[model samples]
Target chain A: MTRFALTIEFDGGPFMGLQRQDHGPSVQQAVEDAALAITGEQVILHSAGRTDSGVHALAMRSHFDLEKLFDPFRLMEGLNAKLRPDPVAVTACEVVADDWHARFSCVGRRYRYLIRNRRAPLTLTRGREWLVTRPLDAKAMHRAAQHLVGHHDFTTFRSAHCQAADPVKSLDRLDVRREGEMVIVEADARSFLHHQVRSMVGTLAMVGLGRWREEQVAQALAARDRQQLGHNAPPDGLYFLAAIYPDD
Target chain B: MTRFALTIEFDGGPFMGLQRQDHGPSVQQAVEDAALAITGEQVILHSAGRTDSGVHALAMRSHFDLEKLFDPFRLMEGLNAKLRPDPVAVTACEVVADDWHARFSCVGRRYRYLIRNRRAPLTLTRGREWLVTRPLDAKAMHRAAQHLVGHHDFTTFRSAHCQAADPVKSLDRLDVRREGEMVIVEADARSFLHHQVRSMVGTLAMVGLGRWREEQVAQALAARDRQQLGHNAPPDGLYFLAAIYPDD
Candidate 1:
């Protein structure tokens, strides 16, 4: 048996998520089905991050073991050929050691949220970015984001359905900047509670819009209650940027 | 009556073209119908550029006259509301002098062509860029583009359906550059024959792919025969970037 590590990119608008579900299609299901058709074996695919619906990914890492031996390039080409019309592509594929893992061995993850701050409706960027008509103070939002940059209980920012054993996690970076009419928020952490990035971005948006003061974000984090969260940004603008592993 | 100039943007994927046609819907029809719904009067729209089907626009200048007085902002908002479900937007609007014409007064036009030069299939930019799997030499392409950047009889690049009275046109700028995985071709001119930009881009692509030498481009231009043209790129990657006027 051989384990292959794949770097995948997908426009998550059509899939339920990166994980498989009984309710609808998913990126995992699509790749797994393609693998089955290629090797005539049912295989389970594991990913570094599980995204929500409407969330995009630039380079998601995943791994699966196959009993049949095939060239790495052939496997990639075959899978891509079968995953057609699904808005998903395997950009890179390579053979990895047996001990390497996709999820458990990952050390960091990064996400970016895109907000189009404009009154005009989006034409080329529709369905790809969150459109916010009101002007945003990106500098203020950046200042407020500094309040949540250390180890703390993120209960206020986590989803109720999150299954992490603990609410405590260290945030490495949180940045907000304006690029013309777009406001971009970048977040990085060793790990995150479900909905943590979206929750943080949504609350920071309040600061950008002057609905919440800089200190108020710190207060909400101290509250340690999900109900205290100002907002939860939509999944449309969130993108899983990259996953960091020791081997890479 | 008031003459208002509008800066419009559209995806152009769903419409037939910028002009009104009996066979199918168009950007002109959409805006004209929106005006009718708002002011209860028939309105005709004149644009600086008449883009073909599948050609997008970043800011297309246009104008219309209306008997009903309207605040510029209100007119823009109402038209946007009525042009719903279509991939079009009125980005800017202002009252212009009665003599200001959308087409006749335009002094310059700029266009940009986007090509995704990579082996991987496009996920996020599908239908928005021309995907070429072959590796391209952008520096070589740029060197060849200089051959077509001057006064010339562009019969080889003009389409058979072109309505221009003369084939002679002054080309101001034609640049080719690579940005990451994408190659952008930008062209500027006082005016162009129909399909001229696409044809130039197509011929340049052959140079980029090492199929034609730099001098062959000059030879093709001197041939003044459409049959000698290398290729014509698809309209999917074309964009009417902007139109320039003297008063602006």
Candidate 2:
């Protein structure tokens, strides 16, 4: 048996999310079914993280083991062929030691949130970006974002349904910048609570729009209460950018 | 009557083109219908240039006369509201002189073509880019593109159905550059023959793929025959970037 690690890219508009559910389709089910069709063996695929509905991934990492022997390139091609008509693609695949894990062995994960700051409605990037018609003070938002860059109790940013054992997590970076009409928010961490990035971005948006002062973000984090959260940005603009492992 | 010049942006996936078509929907029809619905008067929508089917536009300049006086912002907002569900938006609007024509008065037109140079199938940007599996040398393509940048009779690149009186047109700029995995081709000209940009891009792609040498491009242009054309790229990757006017 060989363990394979796959880097995936998918449009999250069609599926329920990355994880399997009884309610609707998922990126996991699509990939697992594709693997089953190729190997004739049902395999459980594990991902680095679970994304909500309408959340996209640029290079999500995942892993699964197969008893059948096949070339890595051939396996990737076969799976992509079977995933046809669906917005999923296996961009990269490689063999790894059985001890390697897509989730537990990961060292870092990065996410990018896209916001289109404009008065006009989106045309080409309608579903891909969060549209904020009101003018945004991206510089002020960036200044406020610096307050949440280190380890802290992120309960205010954690979702009510999050299953993390503890409310504390080490956030390595949270940077915001404006690129043309897009206000990009990049977050990095060793691990994250469910909906943590979205929750933080939602609160920062309030600061950007002048609804809250820059220092208010620090106060929200200090409160350590979910009720103090400003809002949860929609899933349309969130993207799982990459995952880093020890081997890299 | 006031002639309002509007900067429009649209996703071309849903419309036949930017002009009124007999058999299918077009951006012109959508705007005209929206205007009629708002002002209770028939209006003709003229665009800077008529884009082919499935060609997107970032900021296409156009003009239409309205007998009823309406504030530019109100007209723009009302038109966008009525253009519901359509992938079209009026990004900017201003009143212009009666003689300012969308097509005739346009001094420069620019276009951009996107090509994804990768082995994997596209997911997030499926319809928005052209996928080329083979490796491309953007530098070589750019070098070969210089051969077409001056005054020339571009008969080989002209479409058979092109209505331009003379095949001689001076191309101001034709640049090819690679950004990460994307190969972008930007073209500029006072005016262009039908399918000129796509045809040029297709030929440049041949050069990039090493199918045709840089000199072969010169040879094809010197042939002055449409039969000598290498290929015509699809409209999927083409975008009307912007239209330049004299007063600006």
Candidate 3:
């Protein structure tokens, strides 16, 4: 069987999540079903990251194997055509070495979270951005975010539902900045515990809102207790930006 | 009576247009209805520019008058609360001079058109941006757009339904730039004839695609004939970015 890697972009609002689920539809099920219709092959899609419902992705990498070989461009076109009416697009597709895996081969991952700091109700970007009515001190949020940049036992930020065996992980970067009414937070790491990013963002927001002091973020991390978590940001504003590979 | 000026932002995907229509719903109708419900009096909402069906607004300026006066802050918050689930927001509201008019007092209007030039189907920004599946040379498009700037008779670009008495209007700027996979066209003018920006952009796109020479834009303007127009772009990508007033 030939292995193919696909880069996809999707609006996760209508999806149950990125992974296939028995509960409802997912991005993986949508693409796998589309592949079945095109190539008459039932395939399992393995993505680099498993996103929760209501989370978006700009370029999430995934891989699958097919018994029949097809040109990457034609395959991409056919997949996109078959995935119609669904808010999902296969932006890039290519053949990969049999040993290259979409998830296991990846070296790093990136995510971006957006907050619209305003009192006005959202209109244009309703499901795409989180609307926060309170004024956010982005500089304070940025300073607080620095406390989570290095390696740590992030038990305070890990979700109770996380399936990862270890609570300790290395966080490469976490930066916050404000642009007009938007407060943007960008994070990078080799891998993250489920809900870690959201948990961290929610805690840092307390600092921006002047509720939690800057050093409190460090204290929360050291406590390493889920109940000690400040807050957990909604999935509405989070986006799986990209997945990094060794050769890429 | 007290006059109030409002700055609004709306997603036009659900509305027939910005103006009130007998056959369908509109942003103006939504705001007017909200105002009537709030003040128990019918008030007409006048906007700086009349947008076509499926056109969005980032900061459209509008005004309305009411016999019963309410605090500007209270009025704005109430309107936002009443306009729920309609994708319209009163971003700002303030008391204005009785002589001030939303349409007449505006000194300039700004518009932005976005085109996603890619083969992939749109997911997140379906109605918010136009999808064009052709490779466009933005530099050529920009050069061609320059031909339509300055004072000119724009009969070729004006829609047949245009009610403007004269087709001659001074266009201050028409710029075309490429931002990654998107081609953005920004137009600034004292006023524009119906369908002027879309018509000009459609004609300029031909030059970008190598179908029409750069001089064709100038020749089309000189002809001043509707039949000479190359194309008319769709309304999905057009946005009333902002209304410019001389005072501030």
Candidate 4:
């Protein structure tokens, strides 16, 4: 058996998310079907992050085991060809040890949220970006974001449907910046509670809108209640940027 | 009669360009209909540049005359509300002299083109960007662009069906820059021929791909023949960035 790692990119708009579901299409199912078409074999693929519906991934790495010997790069090319019409691509493929797991072997994950802050409706990025009609204060959002960086119980930010065993996790970084009419929020952590990033962004938007202060974020964190947090920013604005590993 | 100068923004994916055409829906028609919906009168609108279909506009300035004393700002808001689901917006409106014309009064026009140079098939920006699979040398493209920056007949870069009376036009600036996997080409001029920018980009792309040399661009221009140029690029990646005019 050979274990192979693949770097993937996908537009999650039409997908139910990274994982396969009974009702609709998924990124994983699309890739698996493509692989089946190329190799005529059924296999389960493991991803570094399980992104929700409407989320996008610039580079999401995954791994799977195949029972036969095949050229790694050719497999990737073949899989991509079969995956056409679906907004998903397998960019890289490399042979790895069987011990390597895409999810367990990962050290951290990075996410980016893009907000088109303008009056005009996004035509090209309609389903890909979050549009905010009101101008946001990036400085205030940045100040409020600092309160969430570090080890803490993120109960207020966690989704009620979150399956994480614990709410306490270390957030290594959370930065918010604005470029022209775009508001960008970048976050990195070893792991995250379900909907944590979206929840935080929704709350930070209130701060950016001058409806909430920086200290309010701290109060929400201490509340340990999901109801204390702001709305969930749409999944459209979120992207699973990358997953970091210990070695190349 | 009162002349109203308005700044517009639109997603050019659905229309045949900025100009009204006999066949398809146009940005001009959409805006004009929106205006007519609010004022209950027929009005003629003029634009700085007549962009082609699939091109976007960040700021396209235009003007229309109205006999009704409707508040220009309020009318803009009303028109925007009426143009919903079409991805058009009237961002700013002000009263101007009756002689003001959206097209004739413009001193310069700025345009931006986006080329996504990556191996992955575009997932998010399918209709919004030009996806070039070949390796593009932006430096070579930038160096070659300088040859067409100054005053030139630009016959090679103009469309065969262009209705311009004269081919001689001064190009104020032409810049090619790289941002991540995207190549950006920015151009500014008093005006342009029908398909000039798209034609130039198509030729520059040939240079970037090593199919054409830097000197080839000059030779094509000096040839003073439309057949000497490369193919006309699609309108997907183009943008009407802004139209500059002197203050009242």
List the global CA lDDT of all models: 0.94, 0.94, 0.94, 0.90
Predictions' DockQ, in order: 0.78, 0.81, 0.93, 0.55
TM-score of chain B of each: 0.99, 0.98, 0.99, 0.97
lDDT for each residue of candidate 3 in B136-209, tens digit (9 for 90 to 100): 99999999999989999999999999999999999999999999999999999999999998899889888989
- Error (Å) of candidate 4 at residue A159 is 1.2
lDDT of 3 by residue, A1-248 (tens): 99999999999999999999899989999999999999999999999999999999999999999999899999999999999999999999999999999999999999999999999999989899989999999999999999999989999999999999999999999999999999999999999999998899999999999999999999999999999899999998999999999999
Model 2: what TM-score? Answer: 0.98
- Flag clash pairs in model 1: none
* C-alpha RMSD for every candidate: 1.2, 1.1, 0.9, 1.7
Estimated TM-score for each candidate: 0.98, 0.98, 0.99, 0.96
Weakest lDDT window of 10 consecutive positions for candidate 4 chain B: B118-127
Docking class of 4: medium
Q: Compared with the true structure, what per-residue lDDT tens digits does model 1 show for residues B140-246?
A: 99999999999999999999999999999999999999999899999999888999999999999999999999999999999999998989999989999999999
TM-score of chain B of 1: 0.99
**lDDT tens digits by residue: candidate 4, A34-133:** 8888888898999999999999998999998888888997898798788989999887899998998999999999999999897656665677889998
Off by over 4 Å in 3: none
Q: Pick the candidate with the highest TM-score.
A: 3
Ranking by TM-score: 3, 2, 1, 4
Q: Residue B108 lDDT in model 3?
A: 98
TM-score, model 2, chain B versus true chain B? 0.98
